[model samples]
Target: MLINKAHQALTDDVVKENFLKYGNPDGPSDVKHGIALPKFLIDGPSSPFLVVIYILMIAVILPIFVNSWWDGVKSYTKLGLHVDTTTYFLEYLLNYNPAELITIEKIIGFLSHAKEFKLYKRSLTPEIVQKLLLSHINRTQLSPSEEQLKLQVVAIAPKLIIGFLDLAATFRNNEVCFQLVETHRCLIQALNPEANATVNKYKEILQLPGASLEKLDTTQPIYTLGKLLKKPTIDPSKFLNIENTKEVLDVAAQIPLIEPLDCKFTVPGESYVPPASTSHVDLRFIVKSPAQKSKPDVSKLSKEVIETQLKDPETLDYLRNPLKVVEDQPKMPLYSVPPYFPDVDYVRQHSGWVAFLILQKDGGKLADVPNYITRVDLSNLKLSPAEFLESKAIVSAYKFPLSTPTPNVGTYHFRFVLRHLLYFGSDLDIPFVMNIENKPVETKRDLYEIEDPDEDSIAGAFAQMRGESVKKFEHEYESSDDEDADDDEEEEESDWSDIDTDTEDESDEKK
Candidate 1:
């Protein structure tokens, strides 16, 4: 009876506030002035123990119920569900129309995408929410009844979809999702014929492979870096000539300029004196090209010839054959040992000497240049020009007869000419001198006076000797003292200067 009165009092208070029931204020009330209260409020067993048990059950359950109701209210507020829970179910179960049902279906569909709402637990991505809302508006217009009824839904769908997507993006607080929202808004704004097409395109983009999906960011422009670079065209004219000017320049850089070769006396220094007891003297000479800085085509640079020359033509006839029988010498005495007389023809075929001379003059021309000549009488010296062209060096031996029992103590010289075809008749002269004496020749101290031999100076000296010469090239072995005196003086002066400088330094230190 107490519970009944309490329940009645609560219902009267609710009625006086005119709270709508079942969606209408004048609807039949659950509580009436004389009506017995329902069992839930007043129909408990009247026994003391049972009544206490019921009170205990209510005590425990009421607070739990209140807590759960409060939580549901909070959840509904957060999800933006403005309808009362009871009315939401009542309309759907009994009096709901197709349009209303479709809205409900869309909300359900929005929640169905758990992945988009995983963080918010009830949120939807703008893309998904926009898709959910536009599906109903852009449906097939085939059914007139459906189309007429939902024209409003279609008219408002765009605005509402945009608003819903914005709310979803704000709720999620994700920059990528916000970008997606903007993209979906643009797609929806541009949607024509059917909204589903844009939705499908958005889905296709999202469902693409990882590499393609990266292009979905609207913040970046759609362009490939590789596309900006065009392929460069290669012109054929640049390489048309196999032997171009560049090749000519490269070849010109490699051909060495013609220069003079250095020559030296191998057998005699400044002088050589034949002993009175000896009937024959031997001579040797060497001619060498300069150390090549660049190798050139020798075939183009050189031409060769061979001839033998002697200053004393009466010494012997080189053109005479030794084996020729003479009627006047038929009774000549037989020798115990056979003499080795050189076959002039054989030596001429093999020797590379350019000139052969028995010096008789103080000065003469070698390759058409002025040079001091050796003063010795010589014979049977052979020469060849091929030696200088091929080996760039000439080393030869010759036996020359001393006409007198005792040799004349005098200067002698020999000359050799190297004609360069490449240089247009420029010729190099190799001149050397020797001295003949009755006594042993002393070591010439003047030879060591030049501290460093200057090969360039030697070449330059020969450069001044250049002349146009068509003479058949010649080789020679000779001896001379005509140049020795001047050379000795120059060398002595050079040595004296070196000695004087050292001596002056020492004197200064002592002082």
Candidate 2:
């Protein structure tokens, strides 16, 4: 009796609100009024109208989310995804006509594929073949609904079936079935033999070489860097006052405008190691030595006498290098190496000798032209080209452990590579088809050609191409004179800032 009274106590207006709000849950009013007057507005459990409404809403949304997930799952499935906006279908067709159009067709093709099979191979039977067809019918056949709706179109154009099979096969194996490959090959041959031959040539190479084509050298193997640097062949005999011959100077009459990573680090108390690096910028080689061999010698022997008196070519070669570079604008001659050099140890402490040589562009001459070369620590600097040379990255540095033959405990080393970023115009375009004589020059894919070395500076080019040419320095061969400017010291690095100096005088400038 009390429960009945309590239930009756609820007004009809409120009950209506409760039904529309709580049980029905159509909006905010539903929750406020329907929320258990005192108990759970869900009086006995809630009305079924609201429950059915919520269930319908969920059913409507669930398909959308599931369909999205399924689309992702079948992203690579061609037949399921192809709807015409894709641009990759040209070469992906495998063949124009697919072999496995129907399940029986596929079974027939499979059986025919091995007519000459050995006796142990499974023999084709109609029942087995029919079952196989049924098994893969989903792959080769169209969805019934789609076929039913689009049948008129498919019937009017029978080739549509062939296309469906091709698309399906592409999804299955990332290639058109065998029927397509042969059919296209035959059609291609029938179309034009010459064009077919040309295409076949590239296909042959692609199928044959795979990746080994990158290994073969095709360019003129630059064997001797001696020609590039114009540095006379060095002979130890000339340096120690032994018998010598005057050598021909490797100087080019004209200076060619040349534009241009390893690490053996020696941290104060650690072993040396390395990473690949790149850098670039002008090297202003200011002649800093009073003893620059290029300076006019005040000896009475004179030019002719000095040239001839040097009985050995190696001796004459020495005079040619520390030559004062002629910097007459638009046509300046570059030096082989810097002149009036400083002791590497002098700068190795404040900065690394390697960095100083290759990275003197920021504060010194050519200071205005933004530098592009930088030292990479994680090697992410070396690998990522855009971020590495961005204006935001004028310079970057990192410290790593290094090793040296020296016994010094405070040794520190770092390798800084400079990248020679070539700028030609506002925009650069990849060569699509370099045509000549009305025909394409099908580029020969030789590694040497692809690995074209820098050819701007003769000396730099020579050094790069023939660094290990003659095995010039033996392992652990100590320099006889500490003042030799580290010639035998593994060429710490190369830099452009010292173009105006002489090689021999470079040693004295550092200290």
Candidate 3:
């Protein structure tokens, strides 16, 4: 039977062709490479055991993934901050009293409580931090252990601040980023214990390199960058060494100071705003580029020149297009390198200023959500100190569109605050007023009342002819109405007399 079947296979045309081509009755077998497992694993009791192991693995891993996802969802907020960390900050800030002075130590203590520190140092705890703060508040010296912990916190602070700045930038939160920058600068200032607390508080001078408490504590009392630049006679080099002085001046030159030229609140095209009209605040300001050692005297241009410049076509164009469009800026590098700040893999940069309007009567509360000013032209920094100061002022303008119309006509008092993002003491608060004009009352004439036309003109001639005819007809009509009214009165009198006579006759008959 096997021989018969083999002969039948060879007899088939397709099989015969395969046999002739490859010397085999059947087509070539497909070669599939796979792992060779033991018979016991594939078909024995071990197979069911392996299936059980697989189910167990999935059961364990699935929960872990789900738990991880849930934890992530719970951990972060919309601001990209840990939920607990934000809660702690909110609680700390909420309890703060405006009357109570906020010191660097208090700020540090507040920051030390942040939960992010736990990720860096497991040893730091609330109890330890509370003790550290209590001791400091009591004016007691820190123990060696406490001192070490404080150092660790200080070291970690820049990284925390940088992280906050990163998150602020990512979220495009200008106010938060500005606050974080100020905190970062304050943290740097806090490192110098030798500096008096008051002197350390002056972030403006402290930001300058080699500007120690001693150098800044000179007779002139240079607390601000403007003060430092304005007083050239009190040479900074005299107090700060030559090399350090140069560094201070160079950095100072880079810092910008805003000198407001004019401010107006008005509608764009119209000269006056009627009641219930839209208007915007126009703030014209020149960014005073800081001089290395000292700023030059006020611009040589007279008031007339300045006024003429303000009305220039270019200036008008700037006012029309107040907001300057800037390309996306890369993160700024830390002015101070390592040893000052930890070697964190992060870049620190100034975002810009926060411009806001505050109603003076509303207890200085914000009138609107703040706008971010990221496009201040700083190309003037590259110029020489003298050239920079003398250079044509960078006329930047800020416009705030009043959201709601002024229904009632009156002046509204507002304070325009231009706060710096990276530095303290560089804010501009200019008070301005907006007036809504009263709408004019229109006196409409009655349709029947017509003015007499000119006598010499054709219209006057026609009106005169028509007027003569109208007056003659009015006179005749008035005479006829008068005659009719007299006759009616006479007839009524006669009727009354007849009634009286009849009453008298009736009385005589009764008698």
Most accurate candidate by TM-score: 3
The order by descending lDDT is 3, 1, 2
- In angstroms, the error of model 2 at 6 is 46
Error of 3 at 255 (Å): 1.8
TM-score of 2: 0.16
What are the models' TM-scores?
Answer: 0.16, 0.16, 0.56
In angstroms, give how far residue 41 of model 2 lies from its true place.
14
Best by lDDT: 3
Model 2, runs deviating above 4 Å: 1-46, 52-178, 181-511
Cα-based RMSD of candidate 2: 33.0
Q: What is the lDDT of residue 268 in candidate 3?
A: 54
Q: Please estimate how well model 1 matches the true structure, expressed as its whole-model Cα lDDT.
A: 0.33
How does model 3 score by TM-score? 0.56
Candidate 3 Cα outliers beyond 4 Å, as residue runs: 1-57, 92-104, 126-184, 188-203, 214-217, 227-230, 264-282, 292-339, 342-347, 385-391, 398-409, 436-511
Each model's C-alpha lDDT? Answer: 0.33, 0.28, 0.59
Residue-by-residue lDDT tens digits, candidate 3, 1-511:
6686479566888877777776666667677974356766768867877767767767987889899999989887765667777776666454645566544455456567778677667877866754553443233467787776665665566555554544444443344444555565555443333235565455576556565555454555666776666665477777454466776676776666676767777665556666676666766665554553333334654465455434333456545653321222222333333223332342233335667767777355555556556555555446665664564444555566767675578877888877765555667879987777875767688998666666656777787888732222233344677788997999999999999999999999999
